[model samples]
Target: MNTNSTIRARRIADDIDALAGITEPDRPYTRRAFTPKFLEGRKWLEQAMRDAGAVTQIDAAGNLIGTIRGAHPDLGTIMLGSHSDTVPDGGRFDGIAGVIAALEVVRALRDQGTVLDHTLEVADFLAEEVSIFGVSCIGSRGMSGSRPPEWLQRVAGELTLEQAIADVGGHPLHSAERDDIKAFLELHIEQGPVLQNEKIDIGVVTAIAGITRIEIIVEGRADHAGTTPMGARKDALTTAAWIALGVEELAKALASGEAHFAATVGEFEMTPNAANVVPARVRMLIDARAERREDMERFVDELDNGVGAIAAKTGVAVSAPRMVSDNLPTPGDADLLDVLDGACQTAGASHRRMASGAGHDTAWMARITKAAMIFVPCVDGRSHAPDELATAEDIALGAAVLLDAVMALDTKLQEDI
Candidate 1:
């Protein structure tokens, strides 16, 4: 596996088949964020990061950078990307195979001429899926300034995440305060099924769960389904289906065996226009996660006391669980997970570590710096959708361990600064 790693794994499978043919071939690989086929797949990945010579841009929260420099460009930068949007019939390699394996690790360091000393960028971020404004790493939370003025007054297609960060050229009140990037790698696609059920070929990660979400709402009293009899009916969709089966039996009794602790309700809604009316109102969302933070505060306090005892035995009137987003657990950076487990044993591959249960932009670029990730192994682990596969030899062995963990985090982050 080295004719320049089979020509960068056939140029990352021909740049993921030309960014999955810039989507919208009448749906099914939709490419959501800012739409128009996600701005023509971010203009074909910003012209494949300017034909791999780098030096591109789009910041101010639209995030599409590129750079390349290195050679002590004032020692700092060393990012890497992930996010080409999708999730609505999504998955052409979840975040487009971590933005084409970080532009094939800057086209394999400009075809091995090497360079390094730091300064390497590569991003692609914007709307890391799950957004119609219900935010999801919207451009790594606006380049880690952590954008949240009500997430620029939420919108999505009709724009207004500050007009989709100034229609992509970005500058929604400038925010690239880069304290010399330092470290940030990414290389996704382990959407789950733990390295193809442990056949393993790389997945270092090690923590990124934290999400919360919530919403709830129940109400009731639409009535008249055959003159509301059933013992004086009130049923807000049967008390939101008994609070979605008590949020899957309180996340399987608080993951008694810790199956990566989770809780979901996915999303449900029911109002007047139903096969029968008696289903006054119901709207759930829930979606908790854990990897600790006191097991996401005891699964949102046992799902807010089991939705107040299923809205007081189904009389209905819930509403009170509304923490729409939390985001805690980010971890991953014990020296970038030992420089990605020594870049998967120096690319001989076969790795393990794990954690990520979805949610990325390297968990909001690990809130500013030294982030990490590098999965690779999707197939039956599936992803947002369109049968989300992965295997141009496990995404070129996770982009050759993300080009040896970005040249060992650009020489171990300049010897720990």
Candidate 2:
């Protein structure tokens, strides 16, 4: 289970640094999908893939794929990748780290003069982050045949998503599901405190949490702030504040339990700009994720009852939480999870099994083929921000683990076939 001799930490650092440098000069580390800066990054990545001896092409789904043919092509493909797009001024390591690690795995295999039984493909998925078009996971969805036809008509500026795909070298009208992939792997920053706090080198993800967004609105009468008594005014803002605090308390209690759960009042708005006037309306959007559907059901039920009590105590009207969007949890492939765990042991990497609180392209790919991913700790467990950090050595270790996993999968998949 020795680490591959060809896996180079310096090379991983260089690739990360190079991608980090492609961001906007005014906004550091911002190579957002469907932008000029993003195209520049793609150009560099494509050239890098070619230099590493890959046959590179953009798929019909707008996914940039670099393939290395294997000794036995009939066994199908073992694909590795993640999205390359970033959130606004988001950290360089979020999605970029995974794509680079996959590319490095391909390079390491080539350097060792080893060809496996399954063809290898490295993908830089398009628009995994919410794009200018207000949609996400475009490439992954398209590749998996889950993208609705209406999505192609989704508009940004004067161009439809269909045109955007064409601009990126994809034929959206012809995008189809890939059945040739025998397995899929990805590596991403942990974006949480568990791994770093536990001092673990790798996290074998058990599943991706289901995401739910709930909306609530509180309504009350506006009155003169100075003239109205403190107790007499029916303030919507205060009622909403109470509900938010209640959410925190409930979420804390749930998180302390066995399964992973988190809820955040990520978006909020208050009406009535006058300082002297009482607030009339307040809307809150809660982002909640749960590993178990039952947990999410419990949360919603408790929230509904809590809001009812608050409405009775106060003179304001609080609407029941309404579902904005809900995505079911996706469990990682059990066999692939075993493969990744074995790879960790083989690479001598310390690791533990965990669930991903954030979504990834792996979830979509899971629908088409056996798929799983690993997480490397990021400093402070922070992501979607400019200050996110992960050490070169840590990422390099993850790359080595991925290389081992790919090698293992090369044979393990053939047995299944």
Candidate 3:
């Protein structure tokens, strides 16, 4: 399996270079969705698709799609892609690599003079990164029919999201759901050190972890910091500190056995401005993520029970954990995962199964189709920053794996779909 030869590392490098140049000159890789820079990047992707012999169009959701007709157009489509837009200073390869790699697969197929049975589509999903519209996965959510209609009215500057969609060649009011996608595949950089540290070539994503944010408030009587005895006065700040420590201990225990669990006291606030005054109140927000529903449930239960004891011991009133936000985990399709595992083997790539700690467009796409994603290694698992890195050689290998998966899906789905 000569992956470098098949995927054409030079084309991949050139595509990255071209798109990397369309960023804000000062920011050096910033291309927020609905911005001019983002649109320019999209235009480049559209033309690249055309050069690969794909018929291109923008969906109502503003997803840029490039389709190459297959031997049997009546059959369902095999979709491969990732987003192209970036966060301010977000590195060059967050979602861009996947899009370019998908394009390369199509070009590689043409080079081999092979035609698939199912039509292939390469997508550059709009705003996979949070955009000026203040929401992420805008294109994917809209495409899957999960995007709230109210979100269409979300405002950014003088334009509503609906207007912005139009500016980018989308028909927001005429939003449509995709029913013909036989399977969807997204190739992304791991954006973490596991792949690189372990010397793995690919990560077969098992699931996209769900995130839940909980707010906990700690209240205590205000007293003079200098006069109040350590045992006599209840300090909200001290109580909050204890709770934060408890959160860490519990999270560490949960993380130990390993189904991708993490909890952080990400937000904290204290009342009273004076340095001499004891904190009258403290508020904390916990950002917890779990790959399995049961793991989250257990973590919440343990935390809730621990909170009562903590407040009792501290003599400070601690409110129950209030869930400010909660979203369930999205598991990859088993059949699709099997296909990816087979793809890795066929491509001569070393890989492992893992769960994504971050959210992705694939999670939304899963709502409507048998969708899954793969991760290639990035330097230090860094992303959403200027220093994030993934080599062209590594990306090409990932593309080869994706190409293999596409071929498998094309043949495998013919009987099922």
Candidate 4:
């Protein structure tokens, strides 16, 4: 790596560390979406962007856009961004890591005092945690125009999309367009154990997983436990447990390393909380994910079949409806991947190309523009927890790679024009 780049990387890291230390610290920087602390963090980030010598502005959707205007007006903007909001009790590193890294990248570019071909922008997206709305990536969804009109009417209580936008200080008409940029790059920590367990410093994410969520309800006759014989009585909880375990088995059967097929039965509830009463109803949520659309569909099918078989054997009624199937698996940009890989190699950071197991904001941006994500290792593969963390050096290395990738894209756009 060149001395200029190394110096720039270190400077950006220093800036990130400083910003992370000062942000809305209500109980150690636990800022949930739309809360007062989250808003404070947003304000601090806005000021930080302005102080970094960038033109800072907020979009209708509460996305803080920090812009370094380019000399070539014909070239479209190139953006580097991530969400600043956190899940409840989430680790400080999850979303803020990306936002701070993006901020530092733009700041570092300004400190380098170089004019770019395409405008450089850093965005701190809002409401990414889904803690407030129960749906993740709210900011990016609005910006990408992927939020269906039906969703606006059906979900999020009685508040329409227009009302929600207005409440959050955004305009609906402007929220649905994507006229700004040619491409995007996001830096984040690998929230899983893949990179850390593999002892890899960086991950070039090839695809973000597509999620399919289902709410399953198993209904059976409520009866007295003492009077109802095991052979005669229908137990909803027992049947639900069978289906849940069956779902895991099916996932194993469908597992092809190519798609990384996985299913999780993360939630379960039993009705009539009493030791003497049989559970009349059991409600469970099954989350299915895969790298490819076909695989995700197969997962859904398997889940349906599993529930069906269990219901038939146990004499329990089963009903499952998909709640969310936002199945857009973001395929990373080929050129962007090349740039990221090159950056990793140049920085002497070992990287493995892998698909992200979890969804991220980049998945939504992929619909409108060329987009990709770079991931650094998280300690013990932990994320979305208060203890989740990555070493400072690892964070710096990831930021350095992001800086190089952004610079490469900036120069490429100039050459194209």
TM-score-based ranking, best first? 2, 3, 4, 1
Worst 10-residue lDDT window for candidate 4 reads: 1-10
lDDT of 3 by residue, 185-234 (tens): 99999988999999999999999999998999999989999999988998
Q: Give the clashing pairs for model 4.
A: 60-170
For each candidate in turn, give its C-alpha RMSD to the true structure in angstroms: 17.6, 1.2, 1.9, 2.6
Tens-place lDDT per residue, model 4, 292-390, is: 888877777777777787788888899965565557577898888998999898777899898887888898889899899999999888888767777
Query: What are the lDDT figures for the candidates, one per model?
Result: 0.80, 0.91, 0.92, 0.77
The pairs that clash in candidate 3 are 191-381, 192-381
Q: Candidate 1, residues 1-417: lDDT per residue as tens digits?
A: 333442377788888888787788777777888878888888888887898898887878778888989888888788888888888876688878878887887888778788898889888888877778776777787788877667787765566778777877788777754677878888888777867877888888788888888898888888778867798988888788888887888888777764367788888877775676778887889888877788779878877887897788767788879898787888788888888888788778878786876778888778778888878888788777788788877888787788887887788777877
Q: Please, what is the TM-score per model?
A: 0.36, 0.98, 0.94, 0.91
- As for lDDT, the candidate ahead, 2 or 4, is 2
Residue 403 shift from truth in candidate 1, angstroms:
7.0
Q: Which stretches of candidate 4 lie over 4 Å from their true place?
A: 1-3, 6-26, 150-164, 320-326, 414-417
Per-residue lDDT value at 47 in model 1: 84
Global local distance difference test of model 4: 0.77
Q: How far is 56's C-alpha from truth in model 1 (Å)?
A: 28
Pitting candidate 1 against candidate 3, the one with the higher TM-score is 3
